[model samples]
Target: MQIKVSTKYLKTSSKKMQPIVSLIKGKKVEEAINQLKFLPKKGGRFLLKSLESGVANARHNFNLPSQDLIVKEVLIGEGPMLKRWTPKALGSATPFRKRTSHLTIILETKPGIEIKKEIVKKEKVEELPIVEEVKKETKVVKEEKLKKPEEPEISKRVFDVRRVASGRHKQNLDRLRRKEKGGIIGRIFRRKAGDK
Candidate 1:
């Protein structure tokens, strides 16, 4: 089984973090921690903490020995950029973007250790046949009755006219109405020409 952990929105750019994380890729957990401890970059410190967190998670949750664990993968991804403005000469401003990164580390057991497999057993269920009881019927004579007139028709479902008439349909309906009855501007121009 493999253990995975992630740290997001670290205050470091992917360009700066890639080189530091490459140093510990595929190394043993303890060795990686040791290498990160001596590094001068802040990204190394954060990465060390994230690796330790993964080790602790494996040890406490999975009962896996830390000695057999090795770093399998290191993934660094770009996160959201924060945009700001810096003052420039001649009454202008320049845009400044601060970059962020997300890091994920995967760890797995060393080679030659037999992995345990779990077997799932399904139980058989027996179904019994259902038997329904029959009832006896008696016959009787029927009498004729006069029928009344049918009532007015009513629909079973209703649709909203407002929803259908919204958006582009509404705009098209307005355009058609304006075309049928010339328009306010046309009437105004005609009245001015008649007066002239």
Candidate 2:
């Protein structure tokens, strides 16, 4: 696997792009390209273009099919640094660096084959199994939640059962009982004797 990159983009230094390339090297070409395309950095665009160009170069130079090859390694290194000076206050100068990058991308055919693997799309991955897995998880959670039994609600009466005979109603009932008594001791203590 051989790859080449040209140093032309002039803005940010190559030091920034090298680290990012290392992280995705040896990854699937489709995945690497997808990630590079979606990234928001200025250097990402340049690196992506270089990677594509490298792949194209490999296919044409090596007589290999583009689809049969995957990016095996990607490398970016600091190139010759351009020096300049920035104006400072009071007749002073500040040193500035104009950075360049050297990018290398390597592609290889699928192991033991002269063709590249068809890039499996993320969206085409089966979804039915995932939905089923989610449903199973939710069912387990619901069962766990129902494991504890709840107590039934009981309506409590407001009456104080112990103090029923302490008020005016209790006194009236007591008077009626006394008035109805006709035994010897009861008659002696009856209200009819004018003991009211």
Candidate 3:
């Protein structure tokens, strides 16, 4: 199986990224990643990200093993350049282009190896017994519920003053609570905000 992953409009020139590709091309996925890890160039980071993405695609989407995969091709194409002017002497501006690159890495499995997809055999389910058991469980649950009456859940609006407030007031209250909790210091010190 062949898996391709492309990262477009990377903020680096194709000329800068081209040399790094030769080091990884025709190499194993793990070796390529290791080689890229020690590289000092900015292009190496970009290439590493693309290569890892390709490997992940091969493993997750195609169910191919990383040990069996090889980097088949690395295509680096020039992307759109951002034109900017730098202030020069005598009130003149020099126009410069910020070059970008589009990197595409193709990974394929090794030769003479056949990929065997796992076949999941479904067992025929007996429904009559299952239905009877479910009915009996429901009856027991209903009897238990009847013995102990459940308390009513309190509405948030009844207790939380913020919920009762509308629009700008609610937003202000939320902002105040957020500020009181931590503010900028909390935001800066917290590790991985996405985890919450």
My TM-score estimates for the predictions, one after another, are 0.57, 0.49, 0.61
Residue 174, model 3: lDDT of 69
Q: Which residue runs does candidate 2 get wrong by more than 4 Å?
A: 1-11, 61-65, 115-196
Which residue pairs come into collision in candidate 1? none
CA lDDT, every model vs. true structure = 0.84, 0.70, 0.86
Report the Cα lDDT for residue 176, model 2.
67
Candidate 2 pairs with clashing backbones: 68-115, 68-116, 69-116
Q: After superposition, how far is residue 104 of candidate 1 from its true place, in Å?
A: 0.6
The candidate maximizing TM-score is 3
Model 2, range 9-128, lDDT digits (tens) per residue? Answer: 446677778667775677766678888998888888887887788667766666665566677766566777889999999999999888886766666666776434356567755655
Q: Which residues of candidate 1, in runs, are more than 4 Å off?
A: 114-196
Stretches of candidate 3 exceeding 4 Å from the true structure:
119-196
Q: How accurate is candidate 2 locally (lDDT)?
A: 0.70
lDDT of 1 by residue, 1-196 (tens): 7889999999999999999989998998889989999999999988999999999998777677778899999999999999999999999999999999999999998988655555669999889765343211111111222344589899755375535534535645767889787787777677556552
